[model samples]
Target chain A: MNRRQFLSWLRRLAKTAAAGVVGLAGSRWLRAGFLGAEAAPPAQRPIRPPGALPEARFRAACTRCLLCGEVCSAMCIAFPSRIEGSQPPLRRAPGAMERQELAPPVWRGDDTPYILPWKRACNLCMRCGEVCPTGALRPIAVDRQTIAREVRMGVALIDRKVCLPWTRTSWCGACLTACPYRQRAITVDHQGRPTVHPEHCVGCGLCVEVCPLRYKAIAVDPPFAPDRGAVRAE
Target chain B: MILRGWLSRRRRRWPGGARKVQVLRRTLQLLVLALLFAIPTLSLYDNLRNQRDEVGIQSRWDTRLVHRLVADLEEPKALTQAVRGSVWTFKAGELVISDPLAVVDFVAASRVPWDRFLITALLPVLLSLLLGRVFCGWLCPADLLFELAGKARNWAGIKTDVTFSRGTKTAVLAAGVVAAVILGNQVFAEIYPPRIVGAELYLWITFGTFGAGAWFFLALIAFEIFVSRRFWCRYVCPGGALYALLGRYRLLRLEVDPVACTECRLCNVSCELGLDPMGGRFGQDCNNCGLCVRACGHDALNWRLGLPPSGGVDRLGHPESGVAAATPGEPAP
Candidate 1:
């Protein structure tokens, strides 16, 4: 190569090296924004669609295609960061707090799907899993047995403090009526008090939707959450 | 053999008819764009119809057309069940096709074994190796959008000649890999234009709202229109960089005819990625999009298979001697 050509080539190489260095350093900084230290609390964890990989893997696995959300028959699945009509970000369901107050990792999951039960609970139709290209949500069969055995989004916890029947505030069996598993997942006692079978509960949140209390008497705790049957004792 | 003879005869009859490749490309682009919207729309319709049937809510929306259309298909399962995902990870039936860059990102970030993606990633890998970034030229939704942005800018009488080093995107690709490995996230996928475009369309069609990615797409368009020309694809796209690298020793490539020579430089201007076809500078960056072939008034540019001649120590491997040796009228090199 000629002297001028060699000099230009050297200049180009330096520029490329500089760019690579900048990109590497910038990406490290950008990673801080892309993911946070694993500090997200259990209760605050959004109920994932049925057959989802555990939270950590799901975050990495999901391409954020939102195909799962697209094919959702019940339309219960919602993206956490959807901006509607130029307004401020919509508030999540009653139990979920303002996004800013949440842990950083929870905010990082903004692109993924979450089932907010108070707004719309998953009917456990198994459609989301069917369309998920990534194995983030493993496709499960539509049969009752498969769903009962495999789908464990969470367990339904009925709070006696607010439950109308449990408090003897005039016989409310709304949860039992709404439960998809009926007597299997939730049962009504002779005194008309309702009991939740956590093992049987697929946590579809149908009971949470039907609960008449302003503060829902029934809540689905994600399976990974600590102390699954804490409410059963109370 | 019969088809080849007939095609040659047709080519002789209408020399300019070779531009049919451009027509085919545009048609494919439109079809892909339509399917991008239609896939989500079909899913939304199915979701709604299923809801109506089970919940017994008498809805006012119409489903007859979609229902009949799907029912008429050879396999309705192909559209709804099998045809899932964007170009990032397209699953058409059992053959799951994933973008090569996404496969790389997933491997680096997830620490998953290559076997996990072997079946899913086979098609795109093979395609890039053979056709050489044909996705960018013939299929990418972003390519279509950026071309339109160029036209719109021209119509507005706006001109911006800003360009960046071609190596910049390779650096960006390197940076993204480093980031993904360190952060355990597909960081580039968030900013990658085609994925963003497909996802934003799906998001809007299904949910009636755009994510923050929509703004990033719009910003890219605006930047292309006002500040730079084909900036993202030419300089920033990690996917494009990855494809360029994979397709570096690609079997298919553009070859310039020295015998039919007139260095008009029109082909250089025609290249969307700012390649120099007239000067015989077609490199891995050349997508073999064939726009330069159509642009040459002299019909000098041709799609040649295999490598261009490795003539001496010439940097570009310019095939002037090879072309001269092949042509009857030229003196043997």
Candidate 2:
């Protein structure tokens, strides 16, 4: 191309780049200001799959290759569909909404993988971490002790009101039997009431999945800051 | 025999160096696509075996030809793990090849891993500087889709002259990088069409399903086919925009020789990017695909080093004027 045409192209490119920078920065500022004001405190922190880095660092590092999700044997790792609280109206038939609700809450996490234990609990295969391209999930070995020590996926919380043994409805030991750690992580009292040993539990959610209660008697609460202060069981 | 007949027909139609270059480029694109497919296919086999072993079930397909061909190769499985990503991979504890724009976002948002960044990001940048957006022409799977879309558009007899400003891509690149920084993620890489294509293909091969990212890629393809031609690459792709910027001063470029000039304007029509090659006015948008060079029956358009010929009368005996050379209907340079 002629020199003047080339020069004009360069000028136009620079102008476009400048416009882009300004437009993006301005839009982001507006979004942050507007969204930040109305944003509610998250109801619960989602359980990141084992070996995940801290939330912020994980967000920054993950390229969303989805390899982790693909390799997950339990298929517990799920990508969040949309931003939190912006759930799209279910477009299925009229009666399908109830079925949708029963099918698991639409995870509001980012495209990063998180386990929904009630649906499918992680078996501690550790394949997701090994295949993770970014260090968002650190590769760890698939041993029980290593997982228990290193993987603090979440802390399991049992609701005594809902638990069959605790509520004096029917004696049940499903959670204890399903616990990979069995006697170490979960044990039954003399009355056949199950008690969780938080220190020994890796929170893989096997028990949560196995719980036969219509609404799970045991739930895995993701490692939230304030919750860490309370020692439920020694 | 039918394939050989078609090949002979194609050879008769193009019949030259440009045809050879096109063939080579197509082969390279296919090779890249196959290489991407290989990674997930191997991983799927290994994953399946691991799962089967966990349950003590033996998969009967272990003896199949496809399995033997893809999984039996020990090196590829090891290599797949070592290079477990598209557009960017962490190999041997170092970031191997990364899209330049993603690197920019990573650096802008957080501390750069200097050593990995150099090899992953700068290497691609340096190659673009030398070769000029050759990746778009040779390696990008999206280009193959776009080409197919172009063919479909022609087959459907849809004539569109919709042209967008070249500056739009630069703006997109700028916006994407800034957004990535603000979002604190490689958002561009996540949605980049080529990367998405590779990832989706991998996911489909492994899991028998596509991810949400596949929808974005499908949308891009649909837009290209129905709305505008090559719109993603021309107007919106940040990766292409980054490559274009790096390729601005590329050493290798299309140079029109003023000697043997036929003002046929075939080259102009042949240009998918709408560059006026007959007037010797290929700007930054020219991907150097050599299509125009091949289309020129007079052998006037050819690859040359440095800039186009400057300050001279055209072979058509018109005064070589600045910028005016690009005016349509002007005699060919």
Candidate 3:
């Protein structure tokens, strides 16, 4: 109503405008932390299995309760979006990585290394687990994201050309039975040795778990040093 | 007319001395009832009206039982004004008898403003400690509901299924505390046991689907209608349990006048909390509804405010007789 009050109002308006700009800019910038481009390439991030909690329990169990997000020692547990009908599709099971991009085929890949980068890993302090009342992640559970498991022992390769099922007319469905993602994710090839489905296979080495062969035909290639060859091309 | 005539005839049948006593007791009963029922509403109404006018406001009354705990948590700076907001915000030497968090959160958030925390949490506990669950029997809304429930039970021919156990309430209290600690300060306000189920419903309906503020309010009425009796207060309320423990050693308590009672079973029938007010452990979970007093066929039972005996109930008067036999003096509880 008065001149001084008007000036004070103007000051408030200016401060609010500045805050708005900063807020927008901050959101845009933080995308680097969240998005697939800067954080992990879209394919590398892992998948969260379906039907974790119904949409209601997700929100009912929380009041924006504590600053679980802010207090998190490891940034693995962040508040899910408060958007309209955007709660779930959260992870039902505990895996190494979470999918950043929610496009086709759900999440990226487990143990892809970038999904949970070696440095930015969950410390298993149970801060996130303890805080969640709905038991999304139990405080004490065997199915947890452990840093030790993801270290690459070697690369695994299949003899796609000569595997009995893929090459010939025999019904040798050995590999399909052994695959871990189970329920026949690995298809029977022409001879029926089993051809790998890239979508289903997460390179967990479970198919290689049971290969009944003399020299262990389906095996991991041990990681090697380039200097072991001792050759100088230059 | 017929009922009034019947009651009048019943009175006439009694002795002249007892009839004279009945008239006096009835008048006293009416006044006490008005204080118990009417004044709380008036206090609320006047408190609101005075707030709008700001000139002829009632002098500030403090009931700071829990407010002191909340003082250190939320606003340590504006303690005075914050304390001034609730009637329970009385100052004391390094201690306040108020649920400060409730008052602080209510006044501060302005999101979910309620007076129940101070009234239910602070006032009842202090009164219970001083006068032993006076509010439970006298003033609280939940206790009021429980009285209605007792009548409803009789009408429906239903009986309580569970025997008394403090386990459920103790667990609820621990859970509320742990949740508050894990969640946030006063985060337990969701299940505050009187807000009580309304806020939880509000959270469920509002957050789970297409929710709005109004829908949350709708959740409130729906919950109040469906929730059976004082289930929350009796079994699950942390605040009620706290008051129960605090009032354990209270100086003044519900005393039986042995000289007065006619064994009419009116005291047991009148009690909303199902306490045999004439029997031992009369104060346990007694909401002090005074229905027992009103129900007395004769002016037998009165909540005589006196210091509890040295051996507690041993020195107190009983109802089965008609003369005061003890020393004409109050003994310490």
What's the distance in Å from true for residue A83, model 2? 12
Q: What is candidate 2's lDDT per residue for A2-80, written digit by digit as tens? A: 9999998897788668758976996675444223211211222246798877556666777666668656766667654
The candidate, 1 or 2, that scores higher on TM-score is: 1
Q: Write the per-residue lDDT of candidate 1 for residues A1-234, one digit (tens) a residue.
A: 999999988977886687589769966754443232222212323578999876667766776767688778788887755221221112232322342243233443346788867567888889888877667788999999999878888767666766798788888888888888999999999999998877688888888778887766677766442232343223
Find the candidate with the highest TM-score and give its number. Answer: 1
Better of 2 and 3 by TM-score: 2
State every prediction's TM-score relative to the real structure: 0.76, 0.73, 0.36
The reply for model 2, stretches above 4 Å from the true place, is: A1-46, A70-76, A80-110, A123-134, A139-149, A161-164, A167-174, A177-184, A212-215, A224-234, B1-8, B11-15, B53-83, B88-95, B109-118, B305-333
* Model 3 C-alpha lDDT per residue in residues A1-234, reported as the tens digit of each score: 999999988977886687589768965654432232222211122211111122222222333222132223433322212222222211321221132132222211111011121112333333443333223223343242331222222223455444455446445655566554454346663445555544344333444445444323343322222321121111
**lDDT score, candidate 3, position A58:** 23
Better of 1 and 3 by lDDT: 1
Candidate order by decreasing lDDT: 1, 2, 3
Error (Å) of candidate 3 at residue A81 is 15
